[model samples]
Target: GAGVSQSPSNKVTEKGKDVELRCDPISGHTALYWYRQSLGQGLEFLIYFQGNSAPDKSGLPSDRFSAERTGGSVSTLTIQRTQQEDSAVYLCASSRDSNQPQHFGDGTRLSIL
Candidate 1:
């Protein structure tokens, strides 16, 4: 079973551009989480989705950040009008439950110039 996976391990883009990062969680997992990690920093919770719907969207930093999970499995984080401030490693994780340990994917590192 795939624990979790992300794409474009590294991405570089100009400011005001848009980017999409993908995540694939482990099978049968019902909880998905999105987090951001700046250089030399800890993971910052972004949004949380249960099944295929986002229930806790409190962590989205700004309107520029949005995400969606479909079929209760695959998820995508889309950044609109990307900015230098948006540069960070986007991480996705999933767990059997909120209290359970989440398995994290490598992450998608995005750089804005």
Candidate 2:
């Protein structure tokens, strides 16, 4: 139950609301990644956190989206001023290292009404 963990498998919110999605990676795993998949769309990379290095935030679409990893273990992705376009499945994955294959958990489905 520890390869990778995500909370609140599904969430529903009104437009303009803010939400936080959480991820807990396996012990000793130093790399974490976030992705988003919309209905009928391919998954898109959102961010990456590797060890103690600065997180790679380039993949995030806008300022409204951001993520942070604390103690290189758990991560939280926050979406501010959510929009209808934000409705999608938010996936989390982790790897022992950056070049290794990552293990993913069931994603959190966010719905904006």
Candidate 3:
């Protein structure tokens, strides 16, 4: 497909476990973004990467959350010591540039027990 794709569309894990979610962006897209959706929390931008370089990571809430990109195409979001509060829908979006509109993937639904 020529759009963003995310793996493990749904995940169920116990509290304190670590989880890794992956996202593959459309071909030739240089900008990728990660966002989280929680009940009452709304859509929150987590991080962004441009051409394998992340210029703004301030959106990441804590050290337990981190992300990285490889070959400027794929990105992975890792959460350490997952908590029930971490349960949310993690979304991935891609754009040609910051000024361009982004296309999103079906978010990965994370459930922490």
Point to the candidate with the largest lDDT: 3
Candidate 3 lDDT over residue span 1-111, tens digit each: 577999989999999999999999989889999999999799999999998889999889899999999998999999999999999999999999899999999999999
Per-residue lDDT over 2-100 for candidate 1, one digit per residue giving the tens place of the 0 to 100 score: 679999899999999999999999998899999999976677999999998898999998998899999999999999999898889999999987889
What clash pairs does model 3 have?
Answer: none
Q: For model 2, how does the per-residue alpha-carbon lDDT over 2-110 read when each residue is reduced to its tens digit?
A: 5788998999999999999999988999999999998767799999999745458877999999888899899999999999999999999999999999999798999
Q: Using alpha carbons, what is the TM-score of model 1?
A: 0.94
TM-score-based ranking: 3, 1, 2
Q: How many clashes in each candidate?
A: 0, 0, 0
Superposed model 2: Cα runs more than 4 Å off: none
In order, candidate lDDTs are 0.92, 0.91, 0.95
- Which segments of model 3 are wrong by more than 4 Å? none
Candidate 1 error regions (>4 Å): none
Which is the leading candidate under TM-score?
Answer: 3
State model 1's lDDT: 0.92
The ten-residue window of minimal lDDT in model 2 covers 50-59
Estimate the lDDT of model 3: 0.95
